[model samples]
Target: MKYNKTYIFGITLVATLGGLLFGYDTAVISGAEKSIEAYLIRPLGLNSLIHGATVSSALIGCVAGGMLSGLFSNRFGRKKTLLISAILFFLSALGSGFPETLFFTKGEPSIGLLLAFNLYRIIGGVGVGLASAVSPMYISEISPAGIRGRLVSFNQFAIIFGMLVVYFVNWSIAYGQTIEWINDIGWRYMFASEAIPAALFGILLFMVPETPRYLVLSNRDEKARTVLTRINADRLRAESILFEIKQSIGRVTERSSIYSYGKVVIFIGILLSVFQQFVGINVALYYAPRIFESMGAAKDASMLQTIIMGFVNVIFTVVAILTVDKWGRKPLLITGSIGMAIGMFAISWLAYNEIIGISTLVFIIIYTASFMMSWGPICWVLISEIFPNKIRGQAVAIAVTAQWAANYLISSTYPAMMEYSGALTYGFYGLMALLSALFVWKMVPETKGKSLEEIERLWKK
Candidate 1:
């Protein structure tokens, strides 16, 4: 059946906005962490540990979001769940930007106000959490099998692009300001910038239809046929696709348990999520400027360096999107894992010798580029593809939840680990990267060129 490529692209673009917000909400903290530490932490006489907790508090909400995504998405539909996330994103952005405005006196320091700020950030994290799981799933279900990988990879591109956008916004905000001024007010503007995109996503989401799969699941066959024909451009082909979806789903009362798809499929999905985070990419993202400063780059120089890294991330993610369908998933994952291992190991060695120069920067770029190309995008593509439709909702929730938990564990423990030993801290991530390569090589099935229904049959074979 012939389909309208432009129409498909437009839907994909709108869905990936959720991905952009996911990236924006999470990485926005990188630029604001120092200000937060100065304004919220130091004022309260808190230590680095508390600062780490504060920085990662949003991830706690992420876990809750992921845990609840299956139930909410199953009940409310993906579009509505995403709409809910958009509202959360908007409110969190405004609240985080002006935490002291509501209750505390302006410029006054207190633990209560800090808690309020963390609460707002956590609310945004919940949005990130929901978007992270639902965005890719939505794209995958809607996209054609031939180009699904490419379309879903766009979500990853959006994630990195969002990070890049915020990096620029953060740098621009602080480009000429004194540290005193930046800490005083510049950070708030950085956080506030996200509100524009959040509002846009919410408004545009209303324009797109609910996914055909969800409509079919809910017994809205007429609506499902409408969406499918719009996407497929041939009523006969749309009906054929709908028939396949219905056959796969069976009766609604016959819902499969989480492990019904076969333990290997579920395990692989969880590991894909886990390894994506355990590779320590978030550490690079969440602390890009600080990592540079630790290498003796001044604050401004570190922001520039972080911006450079953000560009590298965006470029490599584009490479992944272009090649994911052509090159297949396992190859990219394995190759990227090897690249990350080498990069991480080299960085660990340099950090151990206290080498801070272009060499360290080069390795950081290599590591980030590898991740952006491989685990960064492919992991989401696979998770969205691997699960059987019946179990996809709950299964994705579990995998996404594990991913956020792993993200929090690695991100939260990073400062303490670095304090213990820079060599060991990065070396650990390097080791995980190596293991990730082996995991993909041994466990992950090749998913390219297979429809979601086709992929599900692999478990039985």
Candidate 2:
């Protein structure tokens, strides 16, 4: 059947905006973290633990958001849940930028003010959690099997693009500013910048239809058929596809049994989410500037290096988007795992030898690029595809919540871990990379070119 390419991509673009905001809110901290450390923690004589917690406070919200996503997406439908997330993003950006609105004076460094800032960030994290889980699910549901991998992969592309944009935005805000000015005001602007995209995402979300699979779940068959017809561009094909979805979904209330597909699918989904974070990708993302600065680059140069890394990420992620359907998921994931291992192990050796130079930078790019090509996007794809319709919502929430919790543990502990030993820290991630390769090779089933119903049957088998 001929799919409506224009209609498919048009709504896909809207769905991906959720992904863009997820990246924007998550990475915006990269630029503002040091200033947060300087302004919020230092004056209070807080240690690195507090500093790390303050920086990673959003992950706490992410866990909550992830935990809640299944319920919200199930109840509200994917499009409306994303709309909710966009609203949260907007409020978080403004509040995080001017947390004093919560009634604490700026520069006071009171515990209350710190709490307020983290609160706003957590609110945003919830948005990221919802978007992260629902965006890919939405894309996967609406996409045709032939192009689903590529379309769902675009969510990852949007995410990386958003991070890159924020990295550039942050850099622009601080390019000519003095340290005092940056610490005092530049960080606020960096955070406030997110509101623009957040607003855009919220506004555009209204233009897209809810996923047909979701409409089926809601018992809105006519609406589902209408959406499917537009997306498939073949009335008969759409009807057939709709029937297949109903057969797979089989009474939405009855399908929600989390273990209805058996324990293996859930376990694999959880493993994918956990391994993604354990490889220390978030460390590179959240602390790029600090890592570069520690390697002796000036502040501006560190930010510039981050932009370069972001560029590489964009390029490699595009490679993944183009090849995910062609190369297949397992090949890409296993290959990426090996590449990431090599990158991290090399960085570990460099740190062990106290070697700080261009090599360290090269390896960091290699590590992030390897991730961008593989686990970064593939993990989300698998989670969105692996479960049966009977259990997708709760299962995705469980997987994603586990993911954010793992992210919190890894990211929040990095500072103390660094203090103990940077070499060991990186070496540990390298070990995870190797293990991830083994896991994918041994367990993960490839879903390339398979319809969501076909995947549900595969899991049932």
Off by over 4 Å in 2: 104-107, 251-255
How accurate locally is residue 204 in candidate 2, as Cα lDDT from 0 to 100?
Answer: 94
Worst 10 residues of 1 by lDDT: 251-260
The TM-score, computed over Cα atoms with residue i paired to residue i, of candidate 2 is 0.99
Can you tell me which runs of candidate 1 are displaced by over 4 Å?
A: 102-104, 251-255
Candidate 1 per-residue lDDT, tens place, 235-269, comes to 99899989989988883346578877668888888
**Candidate 2, residues 326-394: lDDT per residue as tens digits?**
989999999999999999999999999999999999999899999999998888888988887767888
lDDT for every model?
0.92, 0.93
Which ten residues in a row are the worst by lDDT in model 2?
A: 250-259
Best by the lDDT measure: 2
> Per-residue lDDT for 457 in model 1?
81
TM-score of each: 0.98, 0.99
